[model samples]
Target: MRMKRYPFSNKALKAMIAATVAFTPIAAFGGGFHADQVEAAEQNLNFTDLESLVAYLQTVRKHLTDEDIQVLNEAQEKADRISAEDYVDRILKAPVSEEGRALFVATIDFITEVNLLEAKKEDIEAFAKEQSPNVEAVFESEGTSITMDQYLTYVANVEQKFLDIIQLTEIEDLSEEKHAIALTRALLSAKDPSENAVITKTILRNINQEEAPGAIKELVQKIDPNLSAAKVVVKALKKANEKPEEPTPPGNGGGGTPGPTPGDTTPTDDGVEVTPVVEANGNEVIGTIPDALIDEIVAVVTPEKDEVVINLPKVEVGQTVSLLIPAELIDKLKAKAPDADITVQGDGVSYEIEVEDVDTAALAKKLGVPVSELSLKVSVNPVPSARALEVTKAVQAKGAKVLSQIVDFSVEAVGGDKSVILRNVGNEYVKRGFGLNANVNTNRATGVRVNDDNTFSAVPTRFVTEDDKQKAVVKSLRSSVYTVIEGNVTFPDVDKGNNWAENYIESLASKYIISGKTNGKYGPDEYMTRAQFAVLLTRALGLPGADYDGRFKDVKGDEWFNVEGALMAAVKNGVVAGKKNGTFAPNDRITRAEATAMIGRALNLSFVDFDKEKFNKNKKITDFKDAKKVGASTREDVLRAYQAGIVAGTTKGNFEPTAFTKRDQMARILAEFLIKADLMSELK
Candidate 1:
């Protein structure tokens, strides 16, 4: 009986030849695979049965060199792993044309090259030197001179292009023209709209002159007709289509004339003056605000005080406009609003403001209240200038005391609805011993966004000192009225002097890092389970775990800790590991030594040399009498935790390595670790 034959396509054969030639040297030295063995295997490519191919490859192994034998063995192993049907199906489904293969290969090659570059980033100079030849070849193919800086720029462009390609590939049945339009949309959404405009024009120039405008309009309408990016793309494409092409310069061949070089002040065919595009940090740079539009906006600075009022023209909801303020004016603005995101581009300072009406429903949902309960109010004076006494009176009327000078400023969210950081948001209440006083706790000072109903949502706040002035920093997801307020937060069982961990418990609870047991009672003396400790540690580090898949056999997917992703997060971060039996022992009581080991791992502490003789001579573990009882696997970790001031011995002078850790003790140890490791600032 005759067997069916599966022949390789021309493109597949070419790929095989390229791979063989490229890896021949490595195969020779590594005793892997040689060219002759691959050539022999190629002759037998007609074998439809995977087993028959494996048998044939094995038969040729005895007649080849060591490298050739290794190659034959690898081929045989691959053939053995696949079924005959799958092998035939793969060959049938393979790309037939060189163009199809090239597209697939280019996508894969770009991804591989990017990964390699990222892996070699620590030794980038050496990596770049090795890759220079390949980079040079790319530029040489385009008839361009290459420099090290230009090479870097080319790499960045390739990476960005790869990312753009990946995004476009996600849409089904994406056309070539649609891909070009999508690229324009992405560029227009960048921080510098002017730079994006030039790129959008370039994209438009590449498309068919007859089809470009219609394709852009159709794609933009499908995406968002009102989007600022879409608007910019429409305007840019129109201008690009209207511009007449420049005459071809005299050259060897009639290839179209090249575009103007950087810093070239050549006028276009339409007699409009061309602004030279500056090259900055390997990017084509353009001014954030155009020169012609500067006179449309007005900025008035008052002489009596450091205040600058900006009067902006009417901009649409999603539209972004840049203003170029003078240095002295920027200085005054910064003095009044220190948290404003000010970008200094060349001789001008530009800042973007996105205007949008407040979403009352979303705000109410975020505040955990009904939409009907939201009191939506819009101030007639957008930028209010009020006296201190008047501000104090207003805050008192709202039933909240103000701790800092009334900071009035507008916040602009970068990258569309992203969180904005407000630096130096409030006065230095910490420096004034606010928390040390019996009546108040300065640690409770936090920034809050004032709602129209007089209620406020607490912002994630932190404290830092700049030029000897203590400042409160806050981060908010929306633009609104914000101020600093201090108030006491206490739990029934975790009051002052109740336990050694009272302060730690209250502090962490106030920050929402940990919570009390049922009925608001904190079980300070209760033994903490391994799962409980894992949850607390994950929360303290602010590690994201919502998407984590549980891996432990004993840890069920439906368990509270696993559902919350705490246990999975702990395992993923290498802070905790399962037992040798593959069980997480989630419900088991966690020992003191075990807790310290997890803390040490979280801090990324290095292992100490654990020589018994050296330890006896150096008396490193003598601080705790029962240090010898520490498990060998956990000894180095415990020692690391002790040295880092994250743990301490009991008052009885014993380490108690096998003893179970209690809630209060864990709280104290975790708090100390956070403080010592300077990780407290990461808490929200």
Candidate 2:
């Protein structure tokens, strides 16, 4: 009789699994004498519920051996002797004895070993025919049996269930998918061609068609080098069957496979021979520097012949050096490097030459060789001076705002009475084309000036008046990248006209935090509000998010960056609290005492181990007689803020605790707070 086939659908398959799970047939066995009865019962065993039958099959799925599958197939090919009801009863009533469990486990191992699901249709048919009787006989001995249709249906059910599990799992979640795919691939490779060829084709096709990651593709290639899974599937489905295309060697194209002429040689423009950019190091292409390029030292310390030739030790890129070229060669070298740094070294011993930026193309043309073969190292920056050392020490003593030191600078010719070349004297280099407002005083004279376009033509003559000097200072200090006056910061607006908080404003800007408006105007007298203060505190501490849920009702519509978020974060982090109104009146101006209290909280939160007691206990508040007038609510924080040197009283002995903090005053406090709190690193 022809065997019946039961195809699976998603819905039907789910129903089958659900039905089968209810009937976990625990199997049991004992010696029986009626041999004919056993064979007869095996032939007629029935399945009452299709789902229960499927579930029973699943219980022993992992234990189903190649031999067991073969038995079921062969038995089905023969005949259906058992009734559906009888089959279900026998399976459900079967006690889960040790022997049955062991048999199930063994069958599962066999299926895994042979990759049973991947077996080709013809191979499966052949195995069923060959082992059908044996499969029937074994079940008969256990007093239960299944037809070939039932057995095939059960196998299909089990395979589909596993595949569904893999499919439903998160695609990116590879922990389980990786292991399952790997183990199946191993089994596929180990099984006979007839047993796994079909399944391999299916798996490979799925992997190729899905939006799989590279890792899955790699696994498929590992499974079969000759049989292309996707191509085989396509060929199999074609009406006019054609031969499946040959599989490319593993790692072809973008993978491990090498192209023609592996390790082919190529030459660079410099006459240095090297291999192609693609090298087979684990099948990855990596860039390589020629062996001759590393640690190359080019020496041009001494002149050669009348050409000013350089010796090739090694080529250092981007290094500018002071070259002691002869006066006759100076014009010739300058012509070659018209746009380079060939400034005179102090006292004119050597001309500072930028070797890296120098026209190497021009140099190469002159040398009659490729630029690669041209080797030279140039001094890039000047050596630090005593003035640089002094400036560094002074700034660091004030605060740790300096990021880097002055490495190079240019100066105009120094000769006239007011034409003094102020060499390197600040955090940044004093280069030609650089603008800096400087207040100069050397005991003999005192004046403020600007270095314009590498030249300072300001000359204080006998005819100059006091008002003229003041006007000259203001005009010269309109807008500069930097300014320094008598070891203090000098802002464009903080001149003789308005220098109340000049020291504090300069200190903050130097730390690289506070800044002037786009117009270069530092509004020193503007009132600072609570919302502004919160944002500032948050920035100084590098808090997590720039914005958060609206924790304060009154702080709505404030769309500025970190306006609401900063206030929320501060409150959440216990750095600040709302007033009794339960609203954060962020727009309201904050008083000196209130600002001091918030600053104190920020310090404590940031420092972690900040000594609140010690800060308030030794509070010598600059001999402020009005300190007692400070509100009790903010008295301790007031004293702590004063001692921290961030907040100072008016001219003498008067703590103006109730006074509103100006923008420039706030800047001073923040600068000092950052320094003392050790939070300058967070600015980066």
Best-fitting candidate, scored by TM-score: 1
Residue-level lDDT of model 2, residues 1-684, one tens digit each, is: 622211111112111221121111011001000000000101112334323433433443444445555543433332122222212212221222332333333332223222222334454465456545544443343334544444444444344333322222232332322223322212222211222222222222222111222222232223322222222221222212224799877845575745434222222232122221222233122222232222111111122211122211111111123212222223333344332233222211111333322344544454565545443222213222233334333433443211121223322211112222223211111121111111122111111122332111111111112422211111111112111222233467875657666655654454333556677777788898887777666545434333556666676646563543656666666666677766778778988888988887766662233444535455575477886777777776666667766677788668777889889779768766765653322221
lDDT of 1 by residue, 164-201 (tens): 32232222333333333223222222221222222222
RMSD of 2: 30.9
Each prediction's number of clashing residue pairs:
1, 37
- Which stretches of model 1 miss by more than 4 angstroms? 1-442, 445-462, 467-469, 472-488, 546-548, 605-619, 681-684
Which numbered prediction scores highest in lDDT against the true structure?
Answer: 1
Candidate 2: stretches off by over 4 Å:
1-491, 495-500, 510-512, 561-564, 606-616, 620-629, 680-684
Candidate 1 residue 181 C-alpha distance from true site, Å? 35
- lDDT scores of the candidates, listed in order: 0.41, 0.36
